[model samples]
Target: MKNRILSIDVLRGITICLMIVVNTPGSWSYVYAPLKHSEWHGCTPTDLVFPSFLFVVGLSMSISLKKLNRDNHRKIRNKLLKRGAVIFLIGLLLNWFPFYQTNIADLRIFGVLQRIALAFMLAGIVITLIQNTRSLILSLIALLLTHWSLLYFLGGTTPYDLESNISGTIDIWLLGSNHVYSGFGIPFDPEGLLGTLSSAAQVILGYLIGKNTLKHGKPGTKELNHLAVVSLSLIAVSLVWNFVYPINKPLWTGSYTLYTSGIITGFWAILIWVIDIGKKEKWTLPFKVFGQNPLASYVLSIIVVKLFIYVFKINGTTLYGWSFKHLFQRIFENHLASFMYALAFTFIIWLFAFWLYKKGKVIKI
Candidate 1:
């Protein structure tokens, strides 16, 4: 039990680390290919980061929600609502942070943390209602298929087209173009309402895996073999489905969910093998710290970056740009310099995380 939990913490920490690195490049234009999200279709390492965090969220839920019983339903419901709302509100505030710089009415309505909050709440409710593994599996299947059908049937000829897809259309209609993400050169949000269906399914998959791990007792060689088989099966099925539906991150396609969850599950299995079975845990401290306080670390990193970009200035340039150009860009090629800046920034956050760990602080939110 101890080793299994440690592996989860490490997985979460790794995800948070990569998220900070990818999101804090010196210049978006100069980022390496792997760190950048795919143009539209297909997935990248960066694309997997967010879903991996959600997968961890689900895995954590499996442990936390295990205490749920009929008598505690009301208490759990209130707890879920309160936590979900708080997380969603924080994401919203982050979107509009440095309030003077943001137009109040035009802020993006959905984002990474918001998606996590929603998926967590939805998955919690589903898990509570369906304790049976078979029923939960069926629920997961229904979510994926329902999302796919909506996109293909409701979307016109070009179902997966960036501009015309059903998801984007719905987002624009409901949230208004001004309030939706314009990153895709359209009023589309990757974390929009329609995508939540698949996102919830992703969480349920993680929960199911975690529940299975608990049911089978402590992870060992036999458990590792089972995870490998399941992970490979998910990967194979997703690859085949990719030909038809295409694995898209922005759309949060079913194939993308399956592919990412499979990859993360396989990684988790490796962690258990190394940290538990082999007892090779000497290098796990940093990740364990990160895992212990992920929410605080992630939120702090974003707030600090926002301050650098929006509030601080150096010789007529934002502090972020000035530091990147003067310190990093001057030392190396554009892409490498950009990457170096991200690495340094990630290190700063890691230091903060380490301090919190040393002080025995684990920010629960």
Candidate 2:
């Protein structure tokens, strides 16, 4: 195995923590604006978390494949398939966890990890099989353009609109309305199958960028300069694309891919410079712990929260609400208490991650 890069681990760890914070709110109604996702048409800080995690998946895949014997192509391909399937399975189980809700028709099929699984699988196959850089770039372009065209032509009457888009239509048709997420007061699955195509493009883009980083082999001034130039160009292009397509995270628009990828590219560079190069890494442990076992951390966090809110209750009130009502909400205003609960939960999970980190256990799937 190749020596892992501290910067990638640190960057991914940052997203892992942010994801926990955003998802485990004391109350959805009490979230700070930045923590909340944009209603429909724009990007927010919370929007960055999912894409950034996907980008790390692509980067991590590239890193792993780079260490393998190139002549052993069959082995590499099989490993990719297994990893994707395992991750998908974990997501599926989490969606239907507790086993009490046995109604198969109502279980959510597309979710964060499910999307990660699909995107990583598609990205891995395309990036691995098409070794030619030019061909891979072309494939990436084809995916984005095709998705855009389909959204415009095939989406029912108001294609980009919330209720009538091609995404909601296709998912409701394929998965049945009962399976699609109804959280938004409509039948729309954010992590739906159709969006996987564009989402895969983001992963592919990360793989290509990561391949370049590997080619450079070490983080340095040269790496920082090139990344900055590339990021700026991408951001400019995304800004122009925004006028036409708009940067929508739920839809995972091509422009959103470009915009977030560009922003994170620069952010990744900074982390590389600060943590790996400058030797100023005294405070990077918590995030690195999260990165080491990101999927495990996320799955466990969700399960714990779900149990507290749904399955395990105290005196007929959910442990989740009961804590907020008596401990947090009773002390502070409702919103601040809600926010504190999220932070406390995040800290609790961090302790779990820290123990895993100390034990030197990194759960890959």
* Residues 1-65 of candidate 1: C-alpha lDDT, one tens digit per residue: 35348888899999999999999999998999999999999988899899999999888877877
Residue pairs with clashing backbones, model 2: none
Q: What is the TM-score of each candidate against the true structure?
A: 0.97, 0.96
Model 2 Cα lDDT, one tens digit per residue, 1-365: 15688899999999999999999888877888999999998989899999999888877766777754557766777788788989898888889887785477688888998999999888877876776778988998998998888888987667788877898889988989988888789989989988888899989888878878777677688878888987898889999999888889888888998999999888998888898789778799889899888988999898998899779889999999888888988788877888889889999999999999999998765
Cα error, residue 212 of model 2, in Å, equals: 0.7
lDDT for model 2 comes to: 0.86
Give the per-residue Cα lDDT of candidate 2 at 301: 97
C-alpha positional error of residue 280 in candidate 1 after TM-score superposition, expressed in Å? 1.1
> Given candidate 1, what's the lDDT at residue 10?
92
